[model samples]
Target: MRHSRILADVGAALRFYSRIPVPAGAAEDAFAPPNLKRIAYAVPLAGAVIGLAGAAILIGAHALGLPNLVAAILAVLTCVLLTGALHEDGLADTADGFGGGASRLRRLEIMRDSRIGSYGACALVFSLLLRVALLDGLLALSPTRAALALIAAASLSRAAGMLLLEFLPPARADGASAAAGQPGADAAVRSALVGALLATLLIVPSTGVGATLMAIGLSVLALFAMTRLSNRLIGGQTGDVAGAVQQLCEIAFLMGVLIYARPH
Candidate 1:
């Protein structure tokens, strides 16, 4: 019963977080609207699933003799496809809203517009470039290590993003963030522990203790910076803000791992 409940939560999380189809019998409530508070513990599991898919492509491309850059690009494309670019869209919208709007109301309105602006376009481009470059660098070091890094980064960044939902009130009363609701403190802690466990198991094995610690520290700093920015700029977090935070933290994690990774 306990194991079944965990599976249900993971299935619900993947259904909520990805474009990947959850078959009808995957779980009893897999298709239901997620209770974000209750299923928060499974967010990292969902991220791990997404990351695993991307890692498969990355390893496959490398096995096919593709250049590291090409392999990294394919891996990133796979992740974007799996999530339907959900967080990417959020990051773009947040960039457009925060960079272009002068007021909180205007910012929320801009985010809701769904139209890509100059800021949004730039953010997307930079985000893609950075991920590809970072992954390429890791791949050049070792494909196995790179795959591990991808999974760890994905899980950790998502856990970091959940902190916003735990700590900040919804910025908009009518949007998805508010409607989906916040996680309880216990739920938040579970999410963090799951993410941290994945990172410790994956990153420490591949990146070494020093690099793994650095990666986690950088991810935390990135999360802190995003939280503060969201609070000061918009008075609280929207879904877009959480998404942007994830993107930033992912990049930061990879950067830390790469910088501190032992000479290969």
Candidate 2:
């Protein structure tokens, strides 16, 4: 691909996945909705950039003598802010829809509602708690390793979420996912490959090849489970489902890495 096309794809991925403002001059139609079909393969690159931003906050907080837990929270908070809690909102909505609705249609409606239900609230709390705890534990081992883990998890989770776009039809005729369109198998495969390469390179030096492979395997398993549950519950994929799966895979990846990582 030409450099301009590659840059456009990267910009589109960041525009869709983050709150960061791309320069208007980058493209004539910069304000147009991102084309996910071409952009999906570049999503992992956007994720790695976001991870770098979060890692900066994390390392800076730790360097200032903040507690590891506090540093982790701040780092996560930075990521949430950068992404406008985009994935977290999806996770909350998915939890509410799946837990409270009676049918596929009703579930989609529940997910679209802006109001937070008990199920949504509980899901958000638990997700945040687990992420913070996992990051804290990793930080306790080594700040550098923890930073790299954040990058790997971010990139891999987004890549895993692409499986839904590749394998499942959209549940609704209208919505962000439907509007953006499903990514082609080629784009999805490229995404997975890029995410895996970035994750392996970042994780192996600190966690070793065995732990990195284990983490990747567990992440794939989590992705598969989420894919099955979403299909069963909603009849297809949605933007919310994608977000929820990404969150789940990230947690699974962290758990796998933390279980095997040792202090160096």
Write candidate 2's Cα lDDT for 56-172 as tens digits. 999999999999999999999999999999999999999999999999899999999999999999999999999889999999999998899898898999998887778899999
Residue pairs with backbone atoms closer than 3 Å in model 1 (clashes): none
Global CA lDDT computed for model 2: 0.88
Candidate 2 residues lying further than 4 Å off, grouped into runs, are 24-28
**Which lDDT tens digits does candidate 1 get at residues 1-264?**
399788777878888889888754533555455788878989998899999999999999999999999999999999999999999999999999999999999998999998999999999999999999999988888898889999999998888878878889999898888878888788888898999899999988777998889889999998888888888888999989888988988899888888877646
- The true-versus-predicted C-alpha distance at residue 63 of model 1, in Å, is 1.0
| Model 2 weakest lDDT span, ten residues long | 23-32
Task: For candidate 1, give the lDDT of residue 260.
Answer: 76
Predicted structure 1: lDDT:
0.88
Error of 1 at 9 (Å): 0.7
